[model samples]
Target chain A: MNHLLNIVRKELKELMTIGSFVSVLIMMFVFMGAGSMMGDQGESITSPSDIGFINGDGGLWADRTEEFLISIYVDTYGISEEEARGFVKVMDIPLDDGAAIVEGMRSLGLDAAIAVGPGYSSNLDNGIRAVISEYYIFTNPGLLGSAGSSITSLMIGEISDRISQALVSEIADPDLTPFLLSPIKGTDAHTYIDGELHSGVRPLDISMGVMNQTLMVPVVIMMVIMMIGSIVISSMGNEKENKTLETLLTMPVGRTVIVTGKILSAAIMGLVYGIMYMVGMMFYSKGMTDIGGLGGSSPADLGLALGPVDWLIVGTMVFLAIFCALGLCMILGAFAKNYKAAQTMTVPISVLAIIPMLLNMFASWGSLPTAIQIPLFIIPFTHPMMVMQNLMFGNTAVVLAGMAYLALFAMLTIFITVKVYKSDILLTGIGQTKLAKAFAGKRIR
Target chain B: MDALTVEDVHKVYGDREAVKGIDFSVRTGEIFGLIGPNGAGKTSTLRMMSTLLRITSGRITVCGHDVATESDEVRKIISYLPEDAGAYKDLTGRAYLKFMAGFFADGAEAEKMVAYGMEMADLGDRIDSKVDTYSKGMMRRLLIARAIMPAPKVAIMDEVTSGLDVINAFEIRKIIRKISEQGVTVIISSHNMFEVDMLCDRVAMINDGRTVLCGTPGELKERFNASNLEEVFVKAVKG
Candidate 1:
């Protein structure tokens, strides 16, 4: 019993390292930051009131439709009718002028615009279905970007019910009134994404389509980065543990070659893993799209598919991201005393990868505040995760900028890794400082 | 010609000075031994010569190449076998030898080195097995073969026969003597005074990061009126 206790105590001592504690703390902070970002996004999505109203009908029912929408907005938000009017902008424009509608929405900061047709009231009174066209402005492809349009659709449904209730009370024909209760039907929605209008496609449909394809990209990228990072760091740790690094370092090879060789090999392995994961994810995404009925209108039909050149660009970004991860792992691995400590070294990379992945999943890059976006853009792994969305939206400049930044980041990290390889820290294991020495002693103990 | 030179070498790690102004030189084909007790800075001195650690102050040169500024050139002509060295466990013994040999030579020349290493290790069929399966004696033999197979002008070995049985130690000493006979200068550090007295042509006895005595084994014993190098070390360090 005493021997068993002693063995358990020794195992605990070996497992508890400063590196492990620090890694756990970093992971905690990353999760906390993600939660805060998610909370902000929730607030942004739920309280949307940026709606534009265009009454082309100029009839009693059209006016009534506008009035009912404002009334419902006021009730839902618990605001006065005047304040609700201030939130909903009214425009007098021709229904055929799609360009004017887009310009009006952008200039008015409207999330969506509802345009009533010229014969809406007359058609409804004559027992014919009335048409209301919805124009959605998509500033980003994020899941939250379509929140305003979705809420406006619900408001339109409420207005149709309210108009039906008013008609039923006025008319004595109960059978006709029952059929006319939901007389107002929406026409095919038009979405303006990044200044180009896509006719007949709702923002929600496009958002769902984009989500179906790309939701797994960030996850796969995160996994691949962590996988390759662990491999590189563990390689260093194993070399140190086996005492083979001293022999390799003293060999007639240049430090740069050693650094590059390790990074390149790990990157190749990461690419292989990434390809395997992406193939599996592709089939899974296809199956999901088919089951969810999103396959009827592929993203290609909506002009959201990547061309050959775009895929090449994405390939470059992924390669650069892998290089950056490998370089970073090499630097962290230099401080590792052995394989156990190297496992902890992968935490920072995981945190970096996860931050971008979560942000890409929940929020669009354009929807995020500058403070959040800047850091997200700076993380090397963020580029590959975001490149597909940017290219689909024809934001070529942003994609190019990301690739440039990743290249520069990869170069800088490789330089630093080489410096570490040449330094005594590789062999001495970061014992240059008194605090580090204390930690090293604790780790050994 | 001198195969290696250490001029007033000092190594500082944080606040501690592991090797303080220790100086020595080894001639061509000489079996030079750094004889010291544990923590006497023998391994530190060997590491500095191997270019694995930087000299905090002073200089070391191998075959007219400075270890600090011309480390690549110095590395080309010297081989370092750390006291607790190991090969990649996942690789077979022959593969490990081939990988190390590729750094010095290529293709046919590399194959030649592998054959010679296999001959030196004398493990026969076991050389095809993974390095992780080898016993301690076999591992040591394989490492010794790797270090000597490169035909380095100067070989720096730290505690070459440490943790080995008498038979393994005897076999390694004979191998070291044979390498020295082939005109490769050898600098070996050891805590075993008996081993140093028998294997080394000349010895530097270091204590507490400084050399206490430096002479041929016979001269050191005669000067101290001792029967063996262990007594010589005791008398020198105590006095």
Candidate 2:
């Protein structure tokens, strides 16, 4: 056990000491840092649609809400106080009815407006439903309007909850009211897929998953490819190049143990690089959303829920896929004569792994034409993402297919690596079959 | 009685026979040498004795244990250092020795062995630096130290001082002679006939995968009527 552990430790140490690992680490952190820096500017939202309020009820509750809105303009818009001063205006019109106030807001060219009714305070006192009328035109539909609506809804929800709490305390006990939240029922809001939408599957949360695909996934997948490929290949190639493989083979340790130890070392390195890249991407992604990229939605609208089973399925598939990649690299790396050759050998495989992941960012499986979708379905690399995306939305068929393909691919690659390592050609670099070598005393190295 | 034996041992790769039925034996603590030009099967023979390659036929044994059937036992008692062997560039010389020692010994024994090996290397403070920072001669010193670190019954060293300068080669040969005097049976294959003629208690000349001549350097030199082992090697190839 110590021997195996020592081997793993040595390989890992050597890899980390190599200059490339540090380079990749710096690269991830730098890009992420740049993204996070830009995220600051995006976080400070400047509302494109100004809010207009008509205070008609003159009731304590309605007027209190108005006061709260006025006081929190900077907080709601996420802007500097000086910049938020010009954000909203209280339109003073002679008309007190909700409809008249809304019409007046339109005439005044306000993008969004709210009118409180006379029955609002009375209805609350009577424990009846209180309704506030709203009118709005969303001019900047993409980012500004989305963010404005998100913040507006959140604020409205908070005010309603407070009112409901007051009513519940009246019906029950005032002492317990502040400590208790009011109970209410509401339907969940999800994104709408143009067609083939699942009934209950929440729309893919925009900032976390969708933004992650575009902003984080490509960089992460590339990092995974380079990090794992370079580590695995260079390890074998170094042993072969320096003539240590033969020495190590002669040791009492079994070949499988050596291979497993090397694999474990490389896997650990890949995970480290993956984690670093992920952290960097998280900062970068936040920055992107902050800068009006895949962001703009309030935190509540961005809430994502993935069940335990879905997480399990995605985790298993990703592990299998990465394992398959590692195995493929090991096999190809055996044929290489040097570190450069080893890295070059993995290029095609890296390309295969990367292209699909990048493409998945721009288009969904259903949206792409049948010809394109079929190719995506066939790729082993495509399965992990599909499994992750579909499992949440209850696509059992896609998940099972992806699972089977990944398992088979992983097994096949492992078998190939084992066969190559067991062969004498692994030492000699002979691209020859035993049958072709009628005069085969030649060494590969 | 022989501490090491090779009885008509042969290694065939496909249809190519690299070592064709070579037979020899070394008594306990004797320094045996294999002298041959390129492709003369000298390294192949050392590799076979060291249990690095499978023998196609016949038998090989060290201290009466078969190299084929009891390879693990043979490996424990033997250390093989191939020509131009490279150390892990990232590891310090001291750490490298300790790592090798860990394979055969545990705990205090491993540390003690590593300490002894470091002493043998004679690298001093530079042993703490990574091998990549070491000079070519330093690398050779480290390899030689690692080979004998296990205190093996048999040390198979192939062309140990192959590419060293005069000073480094002399230093390495001096170490080999010192280790031999301490009762470690040594099998060395080298192209340096003078070094072999001086260090080896016995020598064998191989050509075309077969041993054409065998005996001590003086005996072979007298038989060939040559003034030096290099002349003996030249005459053996021609004759």
Structural similarity to truth (TM-score) of each candidate: 0.95, 0.65
Indicate which candidate wins on DockQ. 1
Model 1 pairs whose backbones collide: none
TM-score of chain B of each: 0.98, 0.97
Write one digit per residue (lDDT tens) for candidate 1, span A1-445. Answer: 6999999998888787777777788889888998998777777767746689999999999999889988998888888899888878898778888889888888888868888988988987887778788898776647765655677778878888888788777776766864567777875588886557888777777777787877777878899999999988998999999889999999999999989988988888999999999999999988988786564345777777888998899889889999989889999999988998798788899999998998888777767789988888888898999888888887788899999999999999999999988988899887676877677556634
- Give one digit per residue, the lDDT tens place, for model 2 in B1-239: 68899889887775578889788889888899988888888887887777766788989998999988888788888888888888898999999998788788999998889988998899999999999999889998998898888898888899988888999999998988888899999899988889899899998888878887889999999999999899988888887
Candidate 2 regions exceeding 4 Å error are A1-218, A293-304, A363-380, A404-419, A431-445, B1-3, B7-21, B54-59, B64-69
- DockQ of predictions, in order shown: 0.81, 0.27
Judging by lDDT against the true structure, name the best candidate: 1
Candidate 1 TM-score versus the reference: 0.95
**lDDT per residue (tens digit) for residues A138-180 in model 2:** 3212222234445545555665675665566567755545333
lDDT of each: 0.87, 0.69
lDDT of 1 by residue, B116-153 (tens): 99998989899999999999999999999999998999
After the best TM-score superposition of candidate 2, give how far the Cα of residue A45 lies from its true spot, in angstroms: 34
